[model samples]
Target: MPSALGEYFQDDDGSLPEIELRFAQPALLVAALEYLFGLPGAYDASRDTACVWNLIHDREEPYRSPQDARRVASGELAAFHRLLRAAQVDGCVLPDLGVFVSGEELILDYRMGPQWGESEIVALLRLLARLRKRGAQVAVPWWGESGERAFADAIAGIDAGRSAAN
Candidate 1:
């Protein structure tokens, strides 16, 4: 089975925008790209639901700090390089290509599902936390009706948990 993103990307109509593939692990990069390009059973969406962890960094002032931006950019690049290397060892293929940045934000896009298991989800949450620490806003783009419901449920669960905790 092919992943949802992989199948979508392969469509001739080109519905999706040109996304820059970035990662903290090089191994994931290779696997993700390979799966996107159709490497014969490279990805399985039913078994692998993709997660997008977006990091949004906000600036209070109109003046941007060049030094801070440069540092962020450097960190992003380093993370991506490491991700690429990790993907190679894990038998994961890189997406056709990807973009790199540091200060802007670190977005982690991954496909997960039943097969990914709880451990994977925990890992993803950790990654989200890391991005959040860097001042990025994390979000998951819901697809169809089911996806929307799932996201809603997730939010509800979090809200309920927070209320109970308080």
Candidate 2:
């Protein structure tokens, strides 16, 4: 069988899994949420259906709005950095910090968790694909000066890993 065929068969669900995307910038976070919510009709079904949640005191509370995330992103990030810096923290993952976006069928969860399953990884790939297809510039941290090449390399790595498993 072809490698593509073998890889396809390995996936139980050929659908995009629920995803949580972490953004380095508040503007980027807001933009991603806007796209998922179909700000300019990027997703017809999800338009106007996105909600934001802020993680505080180990609990989630509704943010004023998705755009409101930008307002608090700086403060939250600074505090988070301080927390990580204090006490030689290792493996001390923070719960769903900052803003989380959810829509009709899409979830840009943005939670900091300890484990990542294959489903979550695939979901992230699918999410990036969807975003790129919609004309959004999905810039990841490792993109370096050559984003296209880096992204292509990353996808190839996933495919190679899958092929090895088979």
Candidate 3:
């Protein structure tokens, strides 16, 4: 179960919060890239790193460009396990490889951040919005029930006037 977004940058103990997003299917990772790329921010997919597994040969090949990753993710390799490092054109507070793909789950762990600011939060929410729009189950295990409710409320209130409301 996930909780609400923490109000403070760090816990009372001075540790940063654990933030991660899980996608139930591997294809969702590709969907996430499309969603992120369409955002106002410019993401440098060229710097992205991808490790794609070949289902037929039972071997994995690593790629340093988004084109190759996208090709494999789009069913070129027929693989279920893929890892992608979605590089941001700006900012260093997030993980290097922002997304991970497993057999049936895609994980984005944000714990590598030195800190979580407004930009990071907005990036996360935007990604979540797309996942919801695509009818996939997005789980933020660190955010408890209240966090989930807050997210639902945010999505429900995504009219032109309150698109980013929490």
Candidate 4:
């Protein structure tokens, strides 16, 4: 549900990479992560803060500006913080876990920062495995006959209302 995804710096400038996923149940996403990673890959309290790619800030270390830090007060952001804390994913009040949404079509997003690597995406596959276990519908936009295109085509026939034209 978090659209307009971007990576603006303290000076408000950026075009970094990001990730998104749709799951049926919100908690199931965490459950999936916990089932696979054992630590709910979203937030590790002992590590960082502000999950959504750690809340878009300067790419450099100490990546917080006065204005950016103020966002910690937003209701949406604060709710996510609370959820992680309650889950005991970490002790940090603002653990920079990944990002997520538990709604009609549960969505998970991640802003791959400057240091992203191929290995990081392996975690996503774990999520796919967990989703299959829970019977949650997945919408992966990949390629080839066995990729995103075929998945979309298959769903488009069964659930035209939910499928995209593309």
Candidate 5:
């Protein structure tokens, strides 16, 4: 059996365990998600995460429309779930402090930075809302200064809305 980390890069079965999607810029996150799930021949389970990372990092243009973005996000989420099922993994292990939904949790690890803009924040919140509707909890590992505070604010906003609803 291949290691979980190794399975991502060398399984050769063309199926991946989990994808550690990374985004250096906010605008790319949606596109990355879409490519993960929509673009044909974009993700190779047997390949390393770097391959997928490179593909997104190397893209030259924005998505054609909001519908296209949504399609990609849906596809990526589906692929993520499939990967988890195939590997019997609980959830994805993210590489950066960004919004990612896994299993029953919407996780935001803010140790990376607080450089995200309003659009990214709104998009992430929308994603988290969808996850919550599907019975997932939202969590942030680091919520202090640096990038943590911003993350905390985001979580607080979500929590407050949830609280108000209850």
Candidate 6:
């Protein structure tokens, strides 16, 4: 994390449970990041796959065709996740956000402006839910609220923090 990263993961609600993906465990790390790249709007698999390959100790990247090789790999998982967080589609209120994992913490921030609506937060939550559904370690550290309510409540808390700051 750097001083400039301050704008990316700005202090949201303390209740906003910071996402943490266990990279030390390669299997979980690969599964989660690949799952994220395949989400509706985030389509950059080849690049992400390369980064994932670097994480696996006993694996080599499967051979790729010239076209597949054309995809410039992301510098790291954090950069790839940032691209996904910023992706948007028509009729979808995908938050203009950023994702970066540092020192085991996968940080998600809803940009420096624009309070996200409940539905938008839920959309993002659903992607995370997918990871959780797969038995991945998607821990909601203080969010004991359960189901989608936890995420909505977290976003609401973040909005309140933003309001207080202004």
Best by TM-score: 3
Please state the error at residue 13 of candidate 1 in Å. Answer: 17
User: In candidate 5, which residue ranges exceed 4 Å CA deviation?
Assistant: 1-115, 144-166
Off by over 4 Å in 1: 1-103, 111-115, 142-166
Backbone clashes, each candidate: 37, 1, 6, 6, 2, 0
> Compared with the true structure, what per-residue lDDT tens digits does model 1 show for residues 10-113?
33442322222245543343333333324332333322332222234432222122222343444421222112112221243333222223344333343333
TM-score comparison, 2 vs 3, better candidate: 3
What would the per-residue lDDT of candidate 3 be over residues 1-166, giving only the tens digit for each residue? 1123445223345333333444555566556655554444445443345456666577776643333434554455543322233434334233333444433434554442334555555445555565666645666555567766776665555423344424
Scanning candidate 1 in windows of ten residues, the lowest lDDT window is: 80-89
lDDT of each: 0.32, 0.36, 0.47, 0.34, 0.32, 0.41
Candidate 6 backbone collisions, by pair? none
TM-score list, all predictions: 0.31, 0.31, 0.53, 0.35, 0.29, 0.44
Tens-digit per-residue lDDT, 126-158, candidate 2: 445555444344443322345445445545555
Give the clash total for candidate 4: 6
Cα deviation of 166, candidate 6, in Å: 26
RMSD of each: 14.2, 14.0, 6.0, 13.3, 16.3, 10.5
Cα lDDT, model 6, residue 16: 37
Root-mean-square deviation of Cα positions for candidate 4 versus the true structure, in angstroms: 13.3
lDDT of 3 at 137: 60
Alpha carbon deviation, residue 60, candidate 4 (Å): 33
Q: What is the lDDT of residue 112 in candidate 1?
A: 32
User: How accurate locally is residue 165 in candidate 1, as Cα lDDT from 0 to 100?
Assistant: 15
Error of 4 at 5 (Å): 19
